[model samples]
Target: MRILEGAGTYVATTSNHWEEHLEVPDLSCGTYSLPAGGTDPQSPHTEDEIYLVTHGRATLWTPSGSAPMGPGDVAFVPAGEEHRFIDIVEDFAVVVVFGPAEYSRAESDTD
Candidate 1:
């Protein structure tokens, strides 16, 4: 088993919405945080993902629609779907999980 601490420090140093922490052959996990007015500058991934909100509030938008999100909310996004958080009312933070191992952003960008 592995243990990770210092979430606040981790969040403080993160420069993007997502900061990967664990990567195994079949899955990956990361901390995602965005301050108010911040935007996610990433494209849709090739792997399915789950987001567990831990702090703040925002609206999650996908190709289908948008919905309000806050603490304790869990969101799921299928592979190749367009999505992002908009109108961040506070510093939003979440734990994100990706299945089927390491989702390469470079590869996704090329596709």
Candidate 2:
């Protein structure tokens, strides 16, 4: 088991996203921080994911549509879907969970 103290510490080190494995092999999680007006540079992933907003506000855009997001909001993106956070009104932080653990950019190219 692993315990992380203080989201601020994680937020400080994570410029984009910092991912870590969970106890279960099929699940993984991470935190990302985007300064106001910043954008998420990553593309889509090979595994489904859920984003839990921890701070700030922005609009999550996908091909299907767009929606406003803020603290405590949750968003989901299916595998291979194009999405990004735009028009960041404040410093944004979110916890991302990926299914089939290790399903991030580091592992996507391997498949």
What is the clash count of model 1?
0
Highest-scoring model, lDDT: 1
- Give one digit per residue, the lDDT tens place, for model 1 in 2-93: 86453322254333556777888788888888887777776788888988888888899987999999988999998889998888877888
Model 2 vs truth, CA RMSD? 3.2
- TM-score (all chains, Cα) for each model: 0.83, 0.79
lDDT of each residue in 60-81, candidate 2, tens digit only: 9998999999988999998889
What is the lDDT, from 0 to 100, of the residue 79 in candidate 1? Answer: 85
Runs in model 1 lying further than 4 Å from the true structure: 7-17, 104-111
The clash count for each model shown is 0, 1
Positional deviation of residue 91's Cα in model 1 after best superposition, in angstroms: 0.4
Report every candidate's CA lDDT. 0.77, 0.75
